[model samples]
Target: MNTEQQVETLQSALLARARALADETLARAKHEAERIGAEADTRLRVREESEQASAKQRAERVYRQKVQAAEIKMRAELDQLRWAHVQQVLDALQERLTTLVEDDAVYLPLLKALIARAAQAIEDGDLVAQVNARDYTRLQAHWSTLAAEWVPGKRIVLSPEGEDCSGGALVRNRDNTIRVDNRFEGRLERLADELQRIIVERLFATATPLAMRG
Candidate 1:
């Protein structure tokens, strides 16, 4: 072939080869871009799902904490109410004892029984008995006869000074080492815990729920 014709054919072959390379490069680049986009989409979806789960967990934790706080507050309020009722019962009991002291027919026999019990507790010892002002006078009038009848084989004497109490006797041994407190206020204080328990059981056994109360 002539030189011009051969050069044209060679040039055409080279041009076709360059076009094929460009097309292949463009296809590879497009495939790489598609892979990178798919990976990015997967990562975004996973991040969204993880964030949603974490947010849900945090919300649930907050809800649980709020519920626990509410329960604790409710229990505290119930306890306060229970104690208030207990105090009322205790006050009523004190008032009842005070009223009992005003009635002599009932109170005098009770007082004698208290003295006898105290003397029995301090058995075989010379005893001293003290009472409140009202009871001191009542007992002093017939102390000897009553004392002999109450505690037969024991030496007993009434104190000149009255005790600060609400109508019962405080009896002690001669040496003051042993004493029995058979007084109204003292007995009440000693039995306070048991009384409170009984009061709660009897008065609040069928108590309504605080939320349902009017």
Candidate 2:
């Protein structure tokens, strides 16, 4: 081949090689860009999924907290209601006892029984009997015979100072160290828990049948 023709052929060959390299480089660049875009899309999807999962967990936690708060509030309200109901029953019982104290015929026998019970509880015959102001005078009139029947051996003393009690008697040992409280308030106080249990049971039983209550 001639020198110019050879040179021209060399130039053409060089130009074709450059074009091929440029096309390959562009293809590589495009593939790299596509790979980068796919990776970015995957990362964005993963971040969104993670955020959604975290939000769901947070919402569940908040829901649980709300439920617990509501349960505690309801329990507190129920407790208050139960306490109010129990108090109302006790108040009614106190009123009834006060009415009983006003009736001498009904209360006198009860008083005698209370004194006897107190005497037995103290196990001491020589004890001072303390009563309410109204009962103190009545007890003074019957002291002689009452003492003879209840406590024969030991001397019984009726306190001139009235007790701040709702009927019944408080019998104390000779030195006033030991005492047996047979007063209405004292007895009721001692039995308050049992009375409250019974009252609650009855109230619930009436409101709901035993099977349904469970």
Candidate 3:
């Protein structure tokens, strides 16, 4: 072991240390670069996810608005249709009802049937078969005949003290305790309520109107 040998050994040791340091630095740099790349990728993915969520939310909002608008339009149309139908029914009933009461030829059979039923419910004296004023005079003309089939002169056919009712008739015994209600308007009112319910069920409640779908 001399001075020269010692110097050479020191130089070799320094060189080895430098090489090791260089390798460590390179490895650290590679690790840092990979970490940075991973962070950037994560940021990009997160940003993309946020953008997709925002777009979906916007689409949902637009769709909901369209649905709402459509619903409002449909309701308006349905309301209009119902209003038209109601008007048509009212006008027809108001016009045709007068003609019905005026025609004894048309009403006699119905009156006879009603009178027969009244005959069963009341006692003989002062039993009044009352109807609208329009039909009263026509019905009174044949009292004996009407009563003959009724209670043998026990009752009278009379017109109620009013202009005219839409439909049906009422038979009243003296005490007014006994009465039969057969009114046209009254019957029509019941039918109208039923019709309203049916209409609602047939429209928005159903898949669609067959005629419209066709």
Task: Note the residue pairs that clash in candidate 2.
Answer: none
Q: How many residue pairs clash in each candidate?
A: 0, 0, 7
Query: What tens-digit string does per-residue lDDT give for candidate 1 at 1-214?
Result: 8999999999999999989999999999999899999999999999988899889888878887877777778879988988899999899888888899889888878988988999999865699998998888887989999899887888899998889988788999988999999988888888989999998888889976645221
Tens-digit lDDT track of model 2 for 1-214: 9999999999999999999999999999999999999999999999999999999889888887877777777777766877789899999999999999889889988988887778777766678888989888887887888887776676778888898988888889898888988999899989999999998887656553222110
Reference-based TM-score, model 2: 0.81
State model 2's lDDT. Answer: 0.84
- Model 2 has a clash total of 0
Worst 10 residues of 2 by lDDT: 205-214
Q: After superposition, how far is residue 58 of candidate 1 from its true place, in Å?
A: 2.3
Q: Lowest summed lDDT over 10 consecutive residues: which window, candidate 3?
A: 205-214
- Model 2 misses residue 169 by how many Å? 1.6
The true-versus-predicted C-alpha distance at residue 123 of model 1, in Å, is 3.2
Q: How do all the candidates rank in terms of lDDT, highest first? A: 1, 2, 3
Q: Give lDDT per model, in order.
A: 0.87, 0.84, 0.69
Q: RMSD to the native, candidate 3?
A: 5.4
TM-score-best of 2 and 3:
2
Tens digit of lDDT per residue, candidate 3, span 106-207? Answer: 767776776666656666567766676656666567767767765565656565564256545667777778876656665567577776666556554744
